[model samples]
Target: MLLDTPVRLGIQIRPQHVSYEDIRRAVLTLEDLGVDILFNWDHFYPLSGDPEGRHFESWTMLAAWAEQTEKVEFGALVNCNSYRNADLQADMARTVDHISAKGGEGRFIFGTGSGWFERDYDEYGYEFGTPGTRLTALAEALPRIEARWEKLVPVPTRKIPVLIGGKGEQKTLRIVARHADIWHSFVTPEELAHKVSVIDEWAAKDGTDVSNLVVSNELQRRTTEDADALYDAGVRLFTLGFDGPDWDFDVVRRWLQWRDGKN
Candidate 1:
């Protein structure tokens, strides 16, 4: 388990209602806090609480973050798979991969999923396909993504870690077992354990060891007991999110201390 004892920590700094300066400050603080990974959402606008809220582009910011932070790994929490061509996505990731490889120390965690936001589709002039169709697109694109990664000139500094975030068991977990280095999902701890069991079962049949997978989830509310419980369930990476870069280091610092104590 990644966080079983010395759990790795992550932060999702979703820029909502805050300016770019504050966001930059938050990122720097997270780097200082020793958060393992930093993430941002991929939508053009806000997803919850406010429809007309401040937001930033995901991959563009990630590119900047790659150069800005030397310590923490960074990526989109979940890039909508439907937006970009698979080859294009691969190239973008490769570029960021190299940019972040300060002195050959690259840590770009590529996270993505089938998109679900209709507003993004409508506003961006993309086809709002059905869920099944979206998943099918993702399925077809994964291979092309991998192929492009292999062929991209000056390949990623290291084997870029692929993180797939989703909750669907049958389809999503299956894909995770096949291609992902880290599989992120959302649910209660009980549900998470069950899903892990199913993912393990799939892995056994596929001759893949999912145990090496870094299980991750976003923490909307933080708690010590719950954090420990998640760790006990073989979840190593715990992510806490703050919107608009209100930049509160207290929660991040607490988690860091917790991680140190566990170590």
Candidate 2:
């Protein structure tokens, strides 16, 4: 675990029950407020509130964000690997990576996962396979995604960081050890510690080094003490999510203060 890493803050702007205009404003607001990363989830419909509420596609919104923001790094909090072809996903990520560049490297993080949410799969006509199958597919897809990135013309501005989100010790942690640049999970400090150890063990087995894998976790309902404990346990990136209709900046402001204090 990289315990000495400086603390960074991220915000997930949930794209449910909200207009694109509202999302646009929130993106700008978060960037202006000095957030380290800005994320949105990849889902066809709203995750919470009215199930059939206003929603938008994730990659399209991300392309828009790539052009709109100048400073903050952004991407889907965790893109469902099953939703798109791995090669296409890589090409799209590369294009957005170019789009986000401002006289330098792009600010896109390729956060992805095996995917849950049966509703997304069922409604979209994708096969809702068993969790094991989905994870197996994800494991197969990641290397292809990486290879595709290399083959793409005018390759990505930087080695786009891969942030894998999950806490499963068997498949997910092993995948994290093999491929991830960062690992995101929602777990207690003790659980995080155990998972980190598991990841380290997997890294050894796979002959990969995860010594610099940035540990990430949510901060939505956590107290400062909780944040402190997580930091001690090895988390460096803390993300807080806000759902729309009415997005709250006050909470963001407080967390920004907390982040600044840590740095």
Candidate 3:
């Protein structure tokens, strides 16, 4: 509906099954391969059905990645808003922003959401508020985080793009329209089209022009035309996830070809 430009590729490096050396190598290779962003999950332990399967703290690893890599933008896929105080989160993000910039400037995209992990809350002594309440908390935390960043001792090197990940029609998309620079949702082409329509309607009602807003979705298949169709529908940021230090580059290279208008 609001289509205009080409799409790019993002890769999520799971820090659980891989060694730091493995992750560092993966990052360098992705940079060489021309992937756009590198993301990590924000859980202390595995969230994929196993409590002790594998995992790492999102922010700390991001700091490491920030210092270790040069070109790719980096952030959590979606940091749980309820995990840390909004102000502290802002400070941490700002620190990473500076770290990534090193000296020139940093490129950190803030991908965040209302947490949905019950184990994290139960084990860590966090409130683990009801889903509705957690969403409400996430809603409240966002503005506060932005305000605190403004009050930080040294402001972020850049405005720091905010990406809201969720598909809750009543709340998430509304939040995206209100606050997000990019809206990351999971869907097929049909689902994406439906959501895009809803997003536009919400944007117009809220008097928000989302022309510059990026449409992001996970990459799960190998078909080029499916990727092309998504791009045609205004989706520009494509992200893929992998499970190990093995760091598969086949899918990444294929997507990069599409991203760069190669074969």
Candidate 4:
């Protein structure tokens, strides 16, 4: 898990209970503040606060951000692989990648996961399959998604990096070993070390070299010293979450200062 990768900061601007203008402004602010990545989650309803609060769809908002921002890579924290058809998802990602490129390389990260949100599945009329089934589908769909990207009329500006979220030792890590360019999880440093070892084992079994894989973790609850330990534990990407209705960046600013010091 330890590679010579620079420490990077990301922000997950939660889309619940917020106006589009507010969300747009936050995106611009984060970009100006020099965040390495900007992310939002894919959900139909608010994860916190009022359950039926105002919320935006993920991919549509991402397309808008692709046109609006000039810098800072962006994506869903981890898109639910069970939501959309795999090929369609790839096409959407490719289009956004081109849109964000602005005549140069794009700033899109294809972060995905085997979904676990029952509410999203139930409300959307999608079958809420068992976790094992969902993961199996994800493992099956990824290759098709990559194939679709290659066959698309306008290919992506570059090979889009796949960010797989979760640390399940059996299926998720195996999937990550096979496909992911980055791994994001909220596990503790000790858990991270163990999971990385498991992931390495899976990588070896799959005959894949995952030493170049970037490790990411949440920073909202961790102290600077805690972050240092995480960095020492091989986490190069730290993400801070800002929920909507009053998206505060003061804490984010402090972390940014800490991030700058690390660099």
Best by the TM-score measure: 2
Q: What are the per-residue Cα lDDT tens digits for candidate 1 across 173-225?
A: 87787778888876767778788777777787888776677888766685788
Can you rank all candidates by TM-score, best first?
2, 4, 1, 3
RMSD of each: 1.7, 0.8, 2.0, 0.9
- For model 2, how does the per-residue alpha-carbon lDDT over 1-263 read when each residue is reduced to its tens digit? 67678899999999999999999999998899999999999999888888999999999999999999999999999999999999999999999999999789999999999889999999999999899999999999999999999999999999999999999999999999999999999999989878998999999999999988999999988999999999888899999998875888989999999999998
TM agreement with the true structure for every prediction: 0.94, 0.98, 0.93, 0.98
Q: Candidate 4: worst 10 consecutive residues by lDDT? A: 243-252
Best by lDDT: 2
Off by over 4 Å in 1: 1-6
Model 3 scores a TM of 0.93
Q: How many pairs collide in each candidate, listed in order?
A: 3, 0, 1, 0
Candidate 3 collision pairs = 101-105
Candidate 4 TM-score over all chains jointly: 0.98
Instruction: Residues 35-141, candidate 4: write the lDDT tens digits.
Output: 88999999898888889889999999999999999989999998999999999999999999999999899999999998888999999999998999999999999
The 10-residue segment with the lowest total lDDT in model 1: 1-10
